[model samples]
Target: MLHKWILAAFVSLLGTSSLLADETTQARCVVDDKRRQICLDHPAQRIATLSPGATELMFAAGGGDQVVAVVTFSDYPPEAQAIESLGSLTRLDMEKLISLQPDLVIAWVTGNPAEQMERLEALGLKVFYLEPRRFADVSSTLLRLAHLAGSDDVGQQVAQAFEEGINNLQQRYQNASPVRVFYQVWNDPIMSVNHEHLIHQVIELCGGDNVFADLPRMIPRLDTESILSANPEAILAGGMGEENQAWLDHWQQYPHLHATADQNLYFIPPSLIQRPTPRLLQGAERFCQALDEARAKRQ
Candidate 1:
């Protein structure tokens, strides 16, 4: 009876998967090791990106025209400004989404909850979650999404350029002292990317030593005193918006930090820093250029 029960469960799972699979097989797309489902057949011609990062990636993959709708915060590229606005990635406008009738929904793992994605899938919408974690993963994610969207050649071209840019940046800054960097993502409690995160990868690529590299947590909670103790050389305020500005005005409180004395504290464009997309290479290159300029001025 127990064996029969296990066999029945297996059959049920297979049946459910088959039922879902019958809904759509628009394309065959490579899924990365992270299990990001990419559709190879239909190619997401009428697409709705869930967040700014996904928007940036979609543009990079040459799917600008296929993008029928975007969420509220996808304001970087001028093209995105004209697209229909859904709600924020965290809180979607289902009604708006339904109206757009996107063949594929390029959703986010972090911003959009899993429940909403499941709901969309249950409604027979083809939603693929292409979330990536590290800098090395960005190129793959872009390429994979491009292939899924039927822009594989364009995606590969962009990925190659991005990779080449990173290589150039690393070579240029190969000899510099790894500037001790504290990249501020959130300000109220003083937070930074956890070690092993993609943003942290950007820091390393730009020849900076992450102060929190050894910390056990990815988004570890810490107090101001802890930040003071870390005493980073360069303070990068990746202001998500006005909220990150407090750090820019208040660093004077900790006069001992190397950044304060040398006036090395600065803000990189959040669009480039916050997202794990091709633009992050832009962020790395910008940081390297800034560090070079800072060095020249000091000399």
Candidate 2:
């Protein structure tokens, strides 16, 4: 009777262990930016990033080794440049992407083509969409991507660090004096971002008020007349390339403008500020310093 009882207990224990294992495998589910839940039977071993920002996020999430494919301009971290490129943001090389056979694909919600993303899903590839518009979103994206890539430990560390870094900046500049600013997004069309855009948030963070904050469009096309009328205290711009300072130089042509008068036109690297990645913190630091100099000139 004792022997029979021991055998039954052992069998029950084995059954419980098997059930727990199954539960572990089924628990992998993360909500994408689209508010859709994406699940995988197992943590993804093969991953693909479809945008430059997505590539940087995956690497920051500690999933660099898992990335098998990437799109053009996914050049940050330097190592990503060597990865197989599926093509540009607008057009992807479908055949090459398919050949890679990535179990998971990280896509940009606004940057990537919607139809192509649908086709990837239709083909049975798991797609996780990321659209990090806020600072908190960046940390959350790292957590989610790391969870999918089985790098949660590293992801948590990175996410925490980013949150802390941004918090530090917020605290440092929370009481800073406001400087009226105009941030030029593009030169040919004379574009600037509205208050709703992330760049505007960065401006606010640095205690610089966006001159076009009340503009209806996110990226509004402005004429030189409107800019001259507003006459912002500081003008910040990113150029076509990382080291290009010509955009700021263009402001010099308007010698009477407050920014140009005070020589407050600043050049911020497009990759650091324009892309919503960890490097944005570095950009914010530079932007804040520039604003401080603008303030100093007043004294």
Candidate 3:
């Protein structure tokens, strides 16, 4: 009877040990922006980011130290520059990326080359895609990335802060008078965003109406005639570089235009508004302030 009891106790201990190991190695899964489920046997320890935006989001998700590889133009948070580069967003050095032995890769849905991503998957590498089209999407991305990186606590905090910042902006400008505005995305082709684009949402959040919001394409090439016909009250532009106001200067030739006439041509830094990250709150604040100034001019 004593021997039987001792054997039973040993079996019980073995079962408990197996259960604990299973808990530690439990699979984690998250659906990427592509709506495909990505499952990992355990939280990723090494991560590679394929785009500048992906790099920024990974850092925001508290996986900065785990970032083993990054592509060119990933120059945010200032520390990202120190990471090893695989090359530009359009072209990646696949051999170098494979040599890093990243357990997970953060890819851009529309920005990255699909063939390269496919090759990674074929080699048994896990890849997660991201494309944040809305403010809520950004928060969700933070949480998802953190889940994959085993930094859920930090992700939750940063996501909450970003959501609160955007909410504060929405409350501040919800009732302001609408300002007709034209946002110039590029000067060469004179590109403007439509309602489907994120920038247009920012314009609406600030109680402003986008002059080209009705355009068919997300980024529509425009002519001087269409812009003059709209005659927007405010013109906001992000030039080739931060603080390069040369794009705004081109509008000076059209003195008859309301935006030029009222001196409502505002130059916004490209990175702030262009990248869909936590910093968008800063861009929203600047955009709202610009609209407020335009409103003040009416008085």
TM-score per prediction, in order, is: 0.83, 0.89, 0.89
| Order of the predicted models by TM-score, top scorer first | 2, 3, 1
Q: How many residue pairs in model 2 have overlapping backbones?
A: 0
lDDT of all predictions, in order shown? 0.73, 0.85, 0.86
> In model 3, what are the clashing residue pairs, if there are any?
none
Candidate 3 local lDDT, 106-137, one digit each (tens) = 99988899999999999999999988877777
Judged by lDDT, which candidate is best? Answer: 3
Better of 1 and 2 by lDDT: 2
* Global lDDT of model 1: 0.73
Clash counts for the predictions, in order: 6, 0, 0
State the local distance difference test value for candidate 3. Answer: 0.86
Question: What local lDDT does model 1 show for residue 16?
Answer: 44
Worst ten in a row by lDDT for model 2: 1-10
